[model samples]
Target: MKNLHTRRHLLKTMGSGILACGLSGRSWGQSAESGVYGKRAAEVMAHTHENFWLKKRDLYKGAIDKDDPDFIWGGGVMFSAVVAATRHDPKYKSIMRKYFEGMEVYWDTKVKIPGYEPSPTAGGGNDKYYDDNAWMVIMFLEAYEMSGESRYLKRATEVLEFVMSGWDEVGGGGIWWHEKHTGDSKNTCVNAPAAVGCFRLSKFCEPKEAPKYIADGGKIVKWTTKTLRGGNSLFGDAINVVTGQVNGGQLTYNSAMMLRAYTCLYSLTGEDIYLDEAKKMGVAAKAFTDSKTGQYRDSIKWSHLMVEADLELYRWTKEDYLLKRAKTDCDFHYEAWKKEPAKDLITNGGLARQLWLMADMETAAGRDFWKKSDKLRR
Candidate 1:
């Protein structure tokens, strides 16, 4: 009993020291490859790996207690971050590959239509969420783009098929959030990302098939904008599939995905209207930035995608203020983390999204991967 107690205490100590251990390596002021953002991103990632990663399960637990595995939604977000980190350092490539292998646990093969489930199948649940699978499609495509791995692309395509299965004429053509259709609402969360995923998949498809993806993406974009867009370019949360009543609450990532969709559509079609829409949304999204602190108003998961959309817009518009806003938010958050770590932010999934966003800021500021003049790869 004493030995067991000691082991438990040791594990607790390790979890508690995560932030300190992660931040101990370098001076807060110093910059490294890809500048300060890159350095700090590495630190936070290390903490995530050490404290939350469950090597035995080859998956991340939600928290340091080793209880529940991360929700597949959060896992997908984290996977994208891991893929992004590989751009700054090749060392992350091995970690990214292994993590992707682990993520397959969420893949449900027993169903007539295979898609990623919200929880690990080994734990015996079978329900799938369209939004969760949509996120997987995006993350898998990103992994494929980075590593040129055909398997990643293949998996992304498979998940995208599942996402499309959720689409129906109910309430004028949008993807349902759940496979079981548990909710009456079809969310912007699923539809917008599904559109972005279609645009992304189009790049790798054959000429005959590629246009279909683009057309589908366009249809989704049009439906979502008409159905969800509110004042100030803010998108509402969801719309009831049966009643057609709109859920008026606006969220940052909803607008973020729509902004990315517009940017991607502009890249594909070279339409000034798409660019104009992206700019309008980008301008309106400035409300999410705190006036005094300059920090993002949303939680880390939602706000990171907003910053990513900002960077995508900046790439096209060559707007310096977009970069400045991203830098200010990232810098402030990094310092804030160091000064007084947000205890609530220490979860495996949350840190993963936060790390992904910080690495994107590194890419924006470091300018190592692509330049403002480079064509946006949709």
Candidate 2:
């Protein structure tokens, strides 16, 4: 197809832009607070927007469109980044419509509880894991907050119903990994982000109706902590429902999502315990770094969430060390980019988004990066 050919050409022509350690940064990350590096990050974000997402059904795949069935979970994190990039600068405003259309490509609205589908979903198929739908809920909420669009909120609320459908008496309390795989293990990936969704959904609703959403989120978080708590202030990967056993593995996003949930709860209730727990998890996440090479063990996509958690920690404490750690981790990724940059949509998009996020945390030019919109607010 014409699109596929163009994609191939674009992918091969990155030549210099992609090799400058993600846009010619100065002094590793010391200038993260300055506008120069922030602008460069925005440029990288723009490159990703052009190469992979000008218009495509499969946002997780390469520059070209494809009928991919995998990585639906990564789509949510990518969507969050997309929505954030659009809000961070008005230059990305062109992306908003394309984003909605791409969502249309993935969503099957005819289902009982409407949620997204894989690319080119046949027969309006609603089949997917609960975690994937939960990821979409997070993105839709971001879109709503960023655009102040009621439709985004309504879509997110509908997806919440579907996500809650994933929960039951299983494993004492947690979301099923997939809808059809009834006996599958309950995963922290689903539980933590779903908790974050519920927390955000609470505020998205009316004042009187908000309490139920909040309570639901609190209950999910409570059950998650009690059911599969890991040592060293970290969390595990999953728990086998059939065998009643926990898979004790720590991942960056799992810890990051919990950190977000805890931070949200603290902000809403003024609870120091939530903040304290988040701090513990933040500390544990740094164990990924190799003191010798200064390289991080986490892949770019997964490690981005850790950077997000670190930024939140920085926000709360105003600690320079947290920012420095985040900067170093980012530097590690860019340094790798100089040699072998990932060409896939998830990796490139994720790296750009996280780098921009880190730079935004320090620079006043991006002061409103975490806010709904950093631009002139349309």
Best by TM-score: 1
Please give the TM-score that candidate 1 achieves against the real structure.
0.85
Write candidate 1's Cα lDDT for 75-115 as tens digits. Answer: 77777767777877788898888888888888878877798
TM-score per candidate: 0.85, 0.83
Clashing residue pairs for model 1: none
Deviation from truth (RMSD, Å), model 1: 14.5
Query: Which 10 consecutive residues of model 1 have the lowest summed lDDT?
Result: 15-24
What tens digits encode model 2's per-residue C-alpha lDDT throughout 154-254?
A: 88898888888888996687888877755578988889889888877766686555656766777778777777667676778889988888898887878
The 10-residue segment with the lowest total lDDT in model 2 = 14-23
